[model samples]
Target: MTARVGVVTFPGSLDDRDAVRAVRIAGAEPVPLWHADADLKGVDAVVLPGGFSYGDYLRCGAIARFAPVMGELVPAARSGALPVLGICNGFQVLCESHLLPGALTRNRSLHFINREQRLRVESAGTAWTGRYTAGEEITVVLKSGEGRYTADAATLDELERSGRVVVRYTGGAPNGSDRDIAGIANEHGNVVGLMPHPEHAVEALTGPSEDGLGFFTSVLAHLAGTVPAGADRSG
Candidate 1:
């Protein structure tokens, strides 16, 4: 069966369509979900695509947190029944909603950053990253203002020890994210948040590399019972 992945679109979202296209390229069905609607459209997984939701007012993803859909998503994600991936602004939402730990702060330079970023796979155990081995380097585009990831020392230490830090800047820290983190996952490995835009890099003709496609594909494979919810958890 083909997996149905839902891509959410908020008021000011710019990447929802791109996320849908990426899911299609990964051989899964893309389901467009509206933020105002409480219905999830019954997708196997969910993606909160990157964008300035609610105009990024008060803080990114803050307003969008109260959306009705989150009421459903939080439980599904916590149960490990539905896999959730949050990209860029989506990451902001995850942090705001407490689905994922830590917060995305402004860049140390306090400027919007847009560029292709190289990242290393710090943890391959998440449902979103089963295709890559730990320490593998991949390039994906990152564009955002509040991109820095920060956590208290205790939280950071736990993330490191638990192997939940899924991705990190390879060359060096970008935007001053602690431990060069580019992505992270929850304890169940069902929820993941990354600062880069993977959906923008799924097609060969338009995508930066085939690398980004792996994220969508990995989720499909995981649900297919081929992987024990991320068999490549080897770090």
Candidate 2:
């Protein structure tokens, strides 16, 4: 069977279609999920695309944390039974839902940033990032206002020690994120959150580079048990 990857669409989701297109381009069936629906439709994986969910009310992803779709996604991802990838605003939602540690704060400059951002893959073991080798650099589109990632000192230390830091800004910290962190994964490597818009980088004709296709392809590789070279599949 073709792997089915669900792309959740929140009320204000701006990149859901792009994410769905990426999934199809990666050779997986893209399933559309709604914020108001509790059922997952039995997808092998899920992608939360970027956008200002709930109008960024009370904080970027604060309100979207309570969406009905999250009710199912939260527990499945927490149990390591599902692979979940959160991008941009979706990354903020995962933090708000506490699936991934830390919070995304406003950029130090307090300005909305939009550009081609360079990042280095720190951990290739996560389900969402297995296609890339560790330390490999890639460029992707990054656009966000509250993309600075912050966590307590202890949590930062643990994330580093456990190899949960999946990616980091390589060109320079555009958002003043702590430790130049751009993305992270959970201890089990089933859930990941990234501040860049990988979905927007999948097509060579329309994006800065096709570097982001790895994220979508990596998930398909994960579902097939054919995880790429650098992946740690122990979990």
- lDDT, candidates in the order shown: 0.88, 0.91
Q: On residues 1-235, what C-alpha lDDT tens digit does candidate 1 reach at each position?
A: 8899999899998899999999998899999998888888899999999989999999999999888888888789878889999999999999999989999999988888888888888887888888778888888898988999999999999988888899999877669888898999988888999999889888778867878988898899888876655454555
TM-scores of the candidates are 0.97, 0.96
Off by over 4 Å in 2: 228-235
Q: What's the CA error at residue 83 for candidate 1, in Å?
A: 0.2
What global local distance difference test value does model 1 have?
0.88
Worst 10 residues of 1 by lDDT: 226-235
Q: How would you encode candidate 2's per-residue C-alpha lDDT over 1-235 as one tens digit per residue?
A: 8999999999899999999999999999999999999989999999999998888989999999999999999999998879999999999999999999999999999999999999999988989888888888999998999999999999999999888999899967899999999999887888999999889988889999999999999988888888732246322
Steric overlap count per candidate: 0, 0
Worst 10 residues of 2 by lDDT: 226-235
